[model samples]
Target: MAQSIYLGLMSGTSFDGVDGVAVQFVPGQPLQVLAASARSFEPALREALFALQTPGHNEIEREAQIANQLAHDYALTTNELLQQAALKPSQVQALGVHGQTIRHQPTLGYTRQINNPARLAELTSIDVVADFRSRDIAAGGQGAPLVCAFHAVQFGAPDETRVICNIGGISNITILAAEETTGGFDCGPGNALLDYWANLHLGTPYDTNGCFALSGKVNENLLHTLLAGHYFALPPPKSTGRELFNSAWLNIRLEKFDTLPPQDVQATLTALTAHSIARAIAQFASRCQAIYVCGGGARNPALMQMLGAALSTAGLAHATLSTTDTLGVPAQQVEACAFAWLAMRCVTRAPGNLPSVTGAAGPRVLGALYPR
Candidate 1:
């Protein structure tokens, strides 16, 4: 039998760019990437997205336009990938479109991502699989950390424990235990809070390789205050995002400190992310034998060093996905690749959600299919 091909598209919280990956999955073999492409969100669109993250005046109309614009942008991205690979829409099985997430309030039983998959299919003439979160949320789950199944397929080994830590706009970890154990959940803020601080204080989109953070000193008191949030104490199967850790959240913490250097603030924010992520791994994923870091945060050297230092302090060894010599798949493309895998699963009528990861009542098939 021939392998099936699917395209996955993702615009994560980092708002850095859109990643699209073409994946071929053989029925009984590991998934392989055929081609991949990424295009940064244009400045205007990115600004609009960032604006929506806060309490804005044009919330309703802006959100509706964002949905339409995202679908159009997704179609353009898919078309570019197809053109580059010399593949026609009919040649692929489906496109997994993880629309740009504007709000992911899964606790309310709905997560709003701003892409119309049906419109994407209509424009691109490809079957689209989207809105993968609702099913899990409906089944009494967090509807996040959905990549656990994908992590299992890619990193799960028969004899060794593995941890897949994704440091996207929001960080999450999937623990693939030797045979008896398998679970995952959002660790804490990934690039969200750091990016928020950078944009506010430095007037830049991000710190760019942790340069700003490296120049500053860590504020222990601010770090302690940031860590005191209720979300940090929440047990596994819980998830959070900009909604909880946005500018307002940061201001509340800043109010406690009379004054501080901007770089120091950056340093403390960086520490918050690294420390919270490390703490989660220690508390929930201590048994895992290896930790593989991915997502945008993987690119920040200072954050990685802090994470390594924390792991060492906890008496745990750490390594990144690059260390395993698996950089064939770009860190940015992993989430997008997972969506492609999810599309294939939907087509095969397979369950994509891991009950252990999402705290779901049971295994559930995910995603809504939109026919071309």
Candidate 2:
């Protein structure tokens, strides 16, 4: 039998960069991470892509052009990673490309992510699995938190309950029970508000280790007001993005805090991220034995400290992917690797969508395949 390897490419909600991970899978064996690489998006491309997230008046033709450009950029990213891994296109089974997410209003039964797989496949000369969300949406699912399946495979334990929390632009937690039942839902905003405030006040992409936030003090009044949002009060089996918690949304919350300092606001926003995530875990996953943190937010020391404090207060244990003793292909590479695993599942006609996580009607196969 031949070895099966798949490349997973992902551009997360952070709009920061593209990440690709190559993995090899053998029958009845654990998947092995072969190679991984991440490339930051160029300023121009990033700006164009970010602008599309807003409710702007843009032409359909322009959107189409941007989609093609994104696909090209994704192909370039894939080619670079493949070269760095020293693997030929033929050595890989297929490419799982999660195109940039511009809009993900699954409630309306449609989600738009740029990057045409056919164009990408033609450009990269590899079979492509793209559009991983639509099928789940079609099946009355939110088409999100798809990582739960991958988390179930990698982090699930036979005798213990575990939760994997991914803090990207938004935060989502996957709960794996001792009985092997899995559940997940969007907790709330992760770094999106913090980054927005930092860019506006500090002129930086993010708060390094929550340093800027640490310089100030959290505003309890403001934090309370921010937490009052309806999304935070909602139950599980839900997902969210910049659509509900972006600059505009933040500005609305800021309207009430006329006396708060900008730096203090940054501090409060960071607190909000940590508090909201921790609150969700406490409320929904208190019984879980451990929580493994991932994504860019995991790198922030201040946030980590806050998480630890919050978890301790809740009488829950604080943990991270790092505590597992291996980089395991790095925090940044986990989601990209997930898409690769999803693509592999798609090729095999295996069910990739988790019904309990996404509130989908039931388990379903994920992704649309585009041939080279």
Backbone-clash count (model 2): 0
Which residue pairs does candidate 1 place in steric collision?
none
Q: Kindly report which residue stretches of model 1 are placed more than 4 angstroms away from their true locations once superposed.
A: 54-58, 318-328
lDDT of each: 0.84, 0.83
Give lDDT tens digits, candidate 2, residues 1-372: 246989999888888888888888887666777888778887777788778887778656667888888888788788887887888998888999888888889998889877877888889888999989988989998899899999888777787677788889998888988775688888889998888888888887888778898888989898899989999988877888888889888888888787888889988988888888878888887787777788889888878787777677666754332322242546777898899999999999999999988888988999888887
lDDT of 1 by residue, 32-69 (tens): 87888888888899989988876689798998888888
How many Å off is the CA of 104 in candidate 2?
Answer: 1.4
Angstrom error at residue 50, model 2: 2.0
In candidate 1, how many Å is residue 198 off?
1.5
| Highest lDDT scorer | 1
